[model samples]
Target: MATNKPQTSRQQKHLAVLIDADNAPAAIVEGLFEEIAKYGIASVKRIYGDWTQPNLGGWKKVLLDHSIQPMQQFAYTKGKNATDSSLIIDAMDLLYTRRFDGFCLVSSDSDFTRLAVRLREEGLTVYGFGEQKTPKPFVSACDKFIYTEILRADAVEPAPEPATAPVNGASQEAKPATAPVKAQKVPVDFIAKVLDDIADDEDDWVQLGAVGSNISKLSPAFDPRLYGFKKLSELIKAQPKRFELEARGSNTTGGKDLYVRNRKPGK
Candidate 1:
């Protein structure tokens, strides 16, 4: 009997990336663009801020290097954030154009929470990037939220050198080095629950891809990188006690399919 094949390739999405220069750091721009490329082609890249102010001076070189168009919104009052309003208006204008499949809203402010929700309601995916302190509502509203700290360049630590030999013909024992700290652990229980909820009952196994999708839906900021793993499969495999993985042959695609299931109790 011929087996049915599943579609594995994703359609490239067109995205409009809008940045709030006031709330985001200039250092993350390179990493931000690199991260955005993983999802789709950025057809429109724009940043909003009051260009005349000295505070936004840092963004000048970054904008030129990335070719991102700057949309100036002068502060009309003493303490009002006019940039948010301008960005929201432009986002709506772009939404009406029906040209983009998604929007990347770069800001840590909760002001964009409603905008994200509204965009998703209209069938547009929203990818949010912000600091760890970003509001939960804004993070949850996005389809996927990336912590800018992770996107920034990692600090390099120099490796310890080999111990030197003593001149008295007696070799000294090398001092034991302290182990490096581990990355924060992901919520495995929550992840397993999500997988179980979406798994097929026949075998209690879920497609790896499906599980990844559901996890993102449940927690927009759920990323494998948080656990120091480069990919979701790697992260899952690292937790052998919590899950089981199997690789099956694909019928139509001539590739292997990965299936996963939560480990049985006491197994």
Candidate 2:
């Protein structure tokens, strides 16, 4: 029997999904692409790991099916893991070439926390995907942090059941737990921590562009989809209670620009 499925609309934007096979769960590999396809076209798909290892045997099928190039990292040192470094080096090379619009870093290790930061320094969008156990340093580093568990759950049940209420007119009540509400306040503390961490390493007023840069650098798996916001600006605006916005002079082209800064809750 023929089945109808929603057409996957092609996106104009281009993205790359870089997987650290050592640290990322193989089960979510398909789900990861499904999620990335929502943002843009996956023009590039690469996964880094020691392919010689028996653990990576499972990824071979996926690599062929998805046309993802497998980057093999041999053990360079006894105890030191080389996969993270190799991935970072390759990512830097890709960044300098200016090939892709965004990158998807699929790994659960904190070692990639800095790689994400570096990519953003060059002004590239990053999306991070990892398990819930991913360290705070790594979790906070990305533009967005997506727990793979959530995606796994979503895969099992794509959507929630509609709320049902009693047909009787005697003060029927709807479930409050399922109701949608306005955006939650952007965590000022979290934003401040991110700004401070990046600024401390490089002393400066922290360009608004740079803030975005740092976010992507910290987490290539971060996408605004996790927060139910289409764009970053709308997410910030939704949290006016925590963030303050400002208009700055235009660039050389004379286009108006706005900036976001973290402030005290009341200010």
Candidate 3:
């Protein structure tokens, strides 16, 4: 897994994390924090559920270790989840505070679809974490949605090939681990659509960062991991036949910016 890029104080995002214990598994807690670290600091981490229920008993120790606050909501009625309401209410309260730059909603339930959309409407970025079974509505509602299944990569993803030195300009990056979900078939058409939508034929050299941002907007659940790569640049680089990668000294701070262009025929 790639680590979070170093960010200045201004670039760092303060995020409020809200997890639906009823819908998420306890096993993902470790990987969840690691993944969340990539986006921003967890200013507030809270999980919601009925603590009295034995079904959520597995989460007890995990919460203490992560220092995550547990918000309790009783089962007001059979077959009804009051926890959802509790989480939504608390989320709005946090939103109004205007302290967080984003919200991390961890749940596999589709019920939070409106909640995600509402948060984005308030100009707050919403990052969703859920299982693959999560509905399209919920996934599309967030700014970015990560499937929890990838969090448990070791057990699910096949071992990667040995690493070699990276190439300059057009990177021949090391291959990522094979996914059990078979998402390795690169999203060629999707990439083409995003390129066409963002860059015209004359604008061949589009910054990779801008391309990535648009990809998230068009497909919130689109992740490089799904295509068996750790980063978008690598995913694009892997497709030498379809795309051309360029690295421009790009930043004053000595960071190179990667650029992409659709591979022209016979070149």
Candidate 4:
């Protein structure tokens, strides 16, 4: 049986990270690198924009701090974005080099949709990072798409609501106040379907590692952090009704290996 275990960190992927400074915010740089490190080493990190303009001033310091190469593309005409053209050209140049296993395109612009499609056609995985308002076509083109909102350095966690007091001297149940449940970015039903599709025929239980890999294959940008969970295991644990989780001891080592399966119709 094929295992869903993730490759060792040592077998790191070489990725080319190309950022569109004009469309993406500078605040996400710190978190962005942290996120990318999970997948592999970024072999090439480059940001493109018209450096002469004051609008790109925010990226100046960030570029130096992160060791990102800034490519200047001067705007030759009004109502035209030369940055996108320059990025596309450079991406093609890098793709032809055949050095990178994947390409990380950081932009909220829909114009790069074709570029992503082309890269995928050449068997290169494309990871997209953009704002929530990014076009659906652009998001769908990439192997995985991460929303930049979850990558902000100063991202605010939702505050818990204060407990309500008893009114009119009536005995109020001292119910524990709980934080408001944030709606999951990835729907439960969608996750259930993915789990069911990937479950083994002989055993319904699917290894948590395999489940995570399958999720990434199905939706590259599907991350637990997007839904407030730090790990995939935590995300699975959060939805008890839709799924069941188990930890079985490994044969080689005494450490436990987690497995998950969709809940039965009646159970």
Candidate 5:
């Protein structure tokens, strides 16, 4: 039977990456770009911050390596954040150009929530990168939200071995500045619910890809990496007790189509 399927080979998207240097840490820059590449070509990369400040020194060091143009926005007032304003203005200007397929906003500040919504209203995808502490409004505003903690763990260069130093009047090795943080456990209930909702009948086979899409819709911040799995399929396969998997046909992505079903009480 002839089937109507969308093209498996997704066209490379053009993205405008805008970074809020004050809100985004420099440690995640390498990983940030790597993640962006997965979505599309970074047609424009610009960061907004006060360059003269010493705190942003780390970002300056990586500017040349990544070819990111720094947009200087000096702090004009004591409490006001001029960088956010500058970035938002530039984002709107870039939106009107109509050249980009999407926008990647790197910041944890909630101030960009409205900006993200405005851009999406114009039909551009918004990918937000922020820390775990990022406001839910901003996180929910983007089409996809990636926590920077993951990026730091994945891409930041590891620090050198610590030298012996005096501690509490005795010579001892200094402890590591960054201790490894454990990933949160996968939301099994959420996955089970999505699978059941999609299934036409009990034990009916459902496309894994469809379940993945529904999960994303329910939780934009849902990433298999959070649970230490590289892919959705890997995560599902790990929980064999609750789900059954079957392969029926080949797909365009050079991989076989995987169908999933809710496991019955027995066999």
Candidate 6:
């Protein structure tokens, strides 16, 4: 009998971080990396913009610091945005290559909304990050959408001016500068679709894995990474009042586990 050799398994999560320098702030580039680091190793980091424009001056410095490849697109028309077209074409090309596990799209523009949806249709994760002003279409297009303002990259809260009232004049002490209120912009439509899909199933409370699968079916570019959560469990946990979790059973294969879910509050 000949000795049998065990084959080695190759596994790794490869991520691509593509930035629309025109729509994103250079100040948040480092913070973007910090967010992407939690997902998986970023094998490719590229920023798309017109190098000739002075608007991209800040991006030039950050690109050198982060080793991000700069893709320069010239203006083909006076008023039309050419960079967006170039980036979308490149994204489609990369999708066809099928090399990356996920893509991080750092832009607030809704123009890439279709691109995000298309990538997910091909079974690739998409992480979207932008300012709070990002449109509903773009936000809902991703598996998870994040607002960069919450990260507080540039804005620093100043200390409140002390009260000038005499010690005897005021009995109450002055309050220091309270932290800014961070809004949790819930993807109501997306969440509703997921819940509805799960409810439609034979089991009212479907497995979390199944919910995620349904979400991907509904939107291919869905990724939990963009929401400052590495795993779906964490994202759902953060919205406890919106979701309920239950342990269904243990796994006997490949070290995978299972669970069930519930609706968000007021739903």
What is the descending TM-score order? 5, 3, 1, 4, 6, 2
Candidate 6 Cα misplacement greater than 4 A, ranges: 1-11, 154-267
lDDT of candidates 1 onward, in order: 0.87, 0.71, 0.87, 0.84, 0.87, 0.72
Model 3 Cα displacement at 60 (Å)?
Answer: 0.5
Give the per-residue lDDT digits (tens) of candidate 3, residues 1-267: 988977545238899999999999887888899888988899999999999989998799788899999999998999999999999999999999999999999999999999999999999999999999999999999999998878856333434535566667677754442224445577888897788778855867788889998989899998888777888898899899999999987597788988898888899
| Clash list (residue pairs), candidate 1 | none
The model with the greater lDDT, 2 or 4, is 4
Candidate 4's displacement at residue 211, Å, is: 2.0
- The residue-by-residue lDDT of candidate 4 on 133-196, one tens digit each, is 8998998899889888777732323443466788998887763222123435657877888888
Who is ahead in TM-score, 5 or 6? 5
Instruction: Give the local distance difference test score of model 2.
Output: 0.71
| Per-residue lDDT of model 2, residues 1-267, tens digit only | 977874543355577788999887666776778878877888888998888889988788778887899998998988778999888888888887888777788888999889888877777777788886888887776776677755654422223556666676566576442233233334546566676676543222345666665766555444443455656666666777766666678876697576766654456
TM-score of each: 0.84, 0.57, 0.85, 0.82, 0.87, 0.61
Candidate 6 Cα lDDT to native: 0.72
Residue-by-residue lDDT tens digits, candidate 6, 1-267: 876764322124678888898998887776678777866678888888889999999888877789999998998989878989988888888877878888889899999999999988888878898876788898888876756654433222233334566677757655432222233344646865677766855546666777777876576445454444556776777776657767645575645464545664575
Name the lDDT value of residue 261 in candidate 3.
86
C-alpha displacement of 241 in model 3, angstroms? 1.0
Could you give candidate 5's per-residue lDDT for residues 98-182 as a string of tens digits?
9989999999999999999999999888999999899999999998999888887772233434465677888675554233335
* Superposition error at 45 for model 4 (Å): 1.2
